[model samples]
Target: MISHVLIAIISVLLVAAYLAAVLAGNPVYSALSMGIAFFLTALLFVLLGAPFLAAVQVIIYVGAMLVLFLFIVMMFDLNKSSLTPVRFKPSTILSYFLIMLVLLTGFFVARSVVRMPSGFAITGFGSARNIGFNLMHYYLLPFELASFVLLVGVFGAIAFIKNRRGT
Candidate 1:
């Protein structure tokens, strides 16, 4: 009973923080609010019996990705004057609305399937041990490829920055 109440509270807070992040004026403030949102998401994952996912959410998204976003925002030398309110074009708003509608439709269509999965998971299905084994055995190639791509992207960003500075 208490856990359900806590989950509901956390979920509401998470949505509010996410909205704050999206509607923030400053990029830095947006990034910070997004970090808080990610932390709340991880907390929710922990409450939902997915501790490993929660740890990954905190470590990869909150710790690493948010720091990267902060660095990028800082690197651009953005200031208060540059962060003033901007108006979106009608086309852009319409596109966003259509995309959201499509996503919601798809979600509802999939929700029924999710509620009645064909196969049940084995014991400790979502545990760290199971994840590690599956990652190592089945997903090793794809995982390594993703890491390689990220490494290349980092190198490209460094090169771009260096070129901009003529260094």
Candidate 2:
């Protein structure tokens, strides 16, 4: 019961942190809030009997990804001249409408997920060795696809930076 309470608290804090990140005016504060959210997410994983996943989440999401984002955001010297707000075009109304609809649908789907009971409490579930084996066997394709996506994203970021600098 205590554990469940703890998990619930962490989950609430995670949501709050995400909201804070979204609503923050300062980029640095947003990144810090996201880091807190990532940490909270790792705690939830640990509470759900996935310590290995928690460690990976901390190391990858918090340690690597968040650190990189923070560095990039910090490196940029923001001022009124460089920090212009984007103007939305009337032609993009359909796109915005579609995105809003998708977000609403996702909210409903996520709401339903809260009531679902976890029945996959088997032994060795979410263990490092188990995950390693599954990665090598059942999830190899998806794993490779994710890696490919990350590689493409890295290239995209590089390209975006070069273009922004008029290189």
Q: Assess every candidate by TM-score.
A: 0.65, 0.65
Instruction: Give the Å error, residue 108, model 1.
Output: 36
Could you report the Cα RMSD, in angstroms, for every candidate shown? 12.3, 13.6
lDDT of 1 by residue, 1-167 (tens): 55576578788989899899999888888999999899889867766766678889999998899999998898887876767576798998999999999868855754543342233223354668788888899999998999999999999988876866478
Off by over 4 Å in 1: 81-125, 164-166
lDDT of 2: 0.80
Question: Considering summed lDDT, which 10 consecutive residues are worst modelled in model 1?
Answer: 114-123
Candidate 2, residues 1-167, lDDT tens digits: the string is 65677677788888899999999888877999999998889878866878688898999999998999889887877655646577788868889999899868855854564442354333357778778888989999999999999999999988876866477
TM accuracy, model 2: 0.65
After TM-score superposition, the amount by which residue 86's alpha carbon in candidate 2 deviates from its true location, in angstroms, is: 30
| Local distance difference test values of all predictions, in order | 0.80, 0.80
